[model samples]
Target: MKSKGFGKKALDLLFPPRCQGCGKLIDRDDGLCGACLAKYGDEQRESCPVCGRTARECSCGAAALGSSFIGNRRYCAMTFYNEYNADSERITEKLIFRLKRKNSSSLTDFFAREAAAEIMRLMQLSEERPEEWIITWPPRTPRAVLEYGYDQSEAVARRISYYTGIPWKKMLVRTGGREQKGLGAEEREANVSTLALLRRKEADRKRFILFDDVITTGATVREAADLLYGAGAEAVFPVCIAKTLLKEKTDDEGVFV
Candidate 1:
């Protein structure tokens, strides 16, 4: 019989791998080339330790509000998508656009691995690593699924589960919601409150980590966490790959702005 390695080599020869970030030819099927990988590394390292904002911005307020609805709940994210910083914003937009539009599985896998590592690190810092933590994600609206042909958040969550050795299940169903883009914080919160319903059977799990792609006003995750808490989840930790920085309003004086 032919060896498995021989089959793999034949496939590689037929279809050489390309970098997920730039579509450049590469040796492997599952990651960016050195330059693209370095970009991610630099962003991760430069992001704020507290709220994941880039070095000059402070947006911990939004991060703080992530768990406001659920007392004592923790929230964490990988990096910031700051609109004020053109470069940071552009990179974030590109990453998300590629994931949602192209459905780049290798890119998704790369992000999932990073997120899983962060989740583990956070759990370790808390000193309460549960033996079996349930991994779940906020479901996209059915309309979005229809438009995108797949759910990006779910895709990332499943990959994270695979990387972390944790099981992932669909624990929430999005009933309805208008698109959250361009909405103010208050409107965003109200909109998401009616967006999701928990799956009772799955909700019985003790601990859950709910992840999403980007956290803007944090309304979506907050509402999702509330639903999970209501469904009897002992704890719900919100995780995301990128966070949108809360833009500060300032007057002409620029004092206390």
Candidate 2:
């Protein structure tokens, strides 16, 4: 244990930990600085009065779930995403951008910790056994994989499995399709239709925690959930790092208050 502590100190000296959000020096590794965490973390969370669920988990918005399949599935996210927000330095979006454009162990590790906690919440909410549930993510487009050299969702899912002792598998494949970013709701739905089951036999009678980086219009995840259902999945619970906030939640200034 002394040797381990010595090694950690040496490593810290060589490469001092910095906040993944703003590059501020920090005492810990693989996490955000306290200032950044306080400014952009769960302190900003809002809840729905009627459902007593966080903004991400609330289903009160009329346009929240664009897919019937998603409407029926249990889902939640770590935070809210509002692209139109005036704050250009929003750490949630910045972290997500870093997650896609680079291979940052700190960022992935941070997401994994959050994902593991959220997955456990979903498991408890659904009364499902942790050992019986499987972790899976929709494979990124071929173009994305080639450009980024990694799948962000899969990376987080694997890390979650490592931390939580749950099994992670590659269950769904994206058969060459247009990127979902910057697309309208209908367009996103059409693009997600390209997803197909990679292993139908493996999915039989299993419950899945569908992990993804973001949930917008609920198209991609919903389609993935439908494929899993068709393949005989007993239940599908969707979880993501961020969820697009409904218009009402976004103030006139385009900020999520």
Specify the highest-lDDT model's number. 2
What lDDT tens digits, residue by residue, belong to model 1 across residues 152-226? Answer: 899999999988877897888877556777789988777642556557756764688888987776777777887
* All-Cα superposition RMSD per candidate: 6.6, 6.4
Q: What clash pairs does model 2 have?
A: none
The models' CA-based lDDT, in order, is 0.69, 0.74
> What range of 10 consecutive residues in model 2 has the weakest lDDT sum?
62-71
lDDT of candidate 2 at residue 81, scale 0 to 100:
74
Error of 1 at 222 (Å): 1.0
Q: Write the per-residue lDDT of candidate 2 for residues 40-82, one digit (tens) a residue.
A: 6662475554456675566543233322223334466777677
For candidate 2, the per-residue lDDT at 19 reads 95
